[model samples]
Target: MDNQSLNADILILEGLKVTPRSSIAAFIFLLLMYIFIMVANIGLVVLIFMERSLHQPMYLLFCNMSVNEVFGATIVVPHILRDLFVSDSERYIHYIVCVVQAFCVNLYGGVCHTILMTMTFDRYMAICNPLRYTIIMTNWMVVKLSVAAWAVVFVMVSILLSLTIRLSRCRRFIDNAHCDNASLFKLSCEDVVINHAFGLSYSVLLLGSSTGSVTLTYIKIATVCLRSKTKTINTKALQTCATHFTLYIILMFSAFIIIILHRFPHLSDHRKMVSTVGEVALPALNAVIYGLGVRYCIFWYRSDTK
Candidate 1:
């Protein structure tokens, strides 16, 4: 048989099978999480955009992050919940649907990372070059960076989706609850060296670059804060970067753990748990973490009115 025919046979042999699990509880949990993430992120974005007082570069970046979080969660969590609660027959996503989900998930994931790194740079410019901060982070600059991030992620995801759909599925039953790139790739009968190589290279490049940029930004901020002449200015600088730092640490560590777990087949369940936490839980918590500073900003604004 030709490669395509062989792959088709393998796919037919595997058939559709949903692993029996107590999906009801998982479904409820995921549903609540999706609601929470959507509400919190949407609320934050509205607050940042509507409040003229919050029209600074920092809050603008936060607004963008909030929007990205909403998109990210929408791409993955709803499907996971559906797969858990809905019947197996209803859970069978078409090939095109699966590819689209994977594409959007990866696209938003990449956008999140890039925006985070940009936020770090924004904080760095604010703290280290306060006088020139306005000039450096102009509206034009923000627009350009945002466009570039989305553009790159879109192109990358499109390529990945094309490669993924080209692969003949050897198995229809994905072990995971929802359609994930890694799970789908494992079911393919065709040689996946190119897909694997592209995935690994992109992960390393994006993750490493983002983490490094955030780390360096914080380090410089710290050094600058330590040597500052005024205690109040130093404190404010630190406070401003606090949210970004928290987000950076959480996302980078979670990503690192997920990647490590992914490399070991013996730890598949562990990887799933980690993936769940990283993808679903982390996005929800990020809205909270990043919003903490915003809350303080709002409080200060209110007090000033009094």
Candidate 2:
């Protein structure tokens, strides 16, 4: 059995190896990052809610993204902080808790990508079909899209979690700071054919669909913008789409790469550390990106000055 294997009661999480000084530094830094992520995401959400002027489908999509970031941070950051002070067998987590944690993290990822796709659709309508934007993206329609995205992902990841719960683990040591389906399944000694198939299929289909949908929208948006004779109009159109695309890539690229890395099964420790940190850190990065780049966010910042 592996040194960190599952006993009857607990599964060891030995993913992060940090020196005592580094652990304390990491804890303080992560705690601050988590707090900033929560405050920024929640603050933006509250700002959106309070502002009647910001009640459009576009803003609502941003709100959905923010809420997902907060949800992701909540599920991920506390455990990392806990590990800083608690070590060895005390670092072990209940199997059920591990499963729940994995589900929430994946759930946030799926939903966040879905929300990005939705936002892209909103932008496409606004920029490419400006006259019909209002008529097409009604509040009722927005609510349906938002709810459907969350509901569909909940079902998808729920099935994933259900499958994970039934797996026979020969080893239970997760060598990372986070709980994920891939990490948990690494401990399995049985045939993982079905596990691999379904997991790979689900990830490929979901992420492929989400990113594909967004990319296609941007491509179409770009094509339409290029036809415009006004240089300023064309530049502005491309710039706007580029900003949204950057956020999508920033928020999910690491996870997307990590998902692909699972196929290798021989991923380096450095790569694993980068992926785990990216998973936790991306939400905070999103907040920072939008806070500085989004026009209304800038407006809010300079309101006192004006």
Which runs of model 1 end up more than 4 angstroms from their true locations?
A: 1-22, 87-90, 301-306
Candidate 1: clashing pairs of residues: none
Which 10-residue window of candidate 2 scores lowest in summed lDDT? 292-301
Candidates' C-alpha lDDT: 0.76, 0.79
In model 2, which regions exceed 4 Å deviation?
1-7, 230-236, 264-268, 296-306
Model 2 scores a C-alpha lDDT of 0.79
TM-score of each: 0.87, 0.89
- Tens digits of lDDT, candidate 1, 84-187: 54554455655656666667777877888888888888888888998999998998898877787788878877777677778866576655544556766887
Q: Write the per-residue lDDT of candidate 2 for residues 183-217, one digit (tens) a residue.
A: 87777887877777888789888878877898788
Deviation from native of the Cα of residue 207 in model 1, angstroms: 0.8
Specify the highest-lDDT model's number: 2
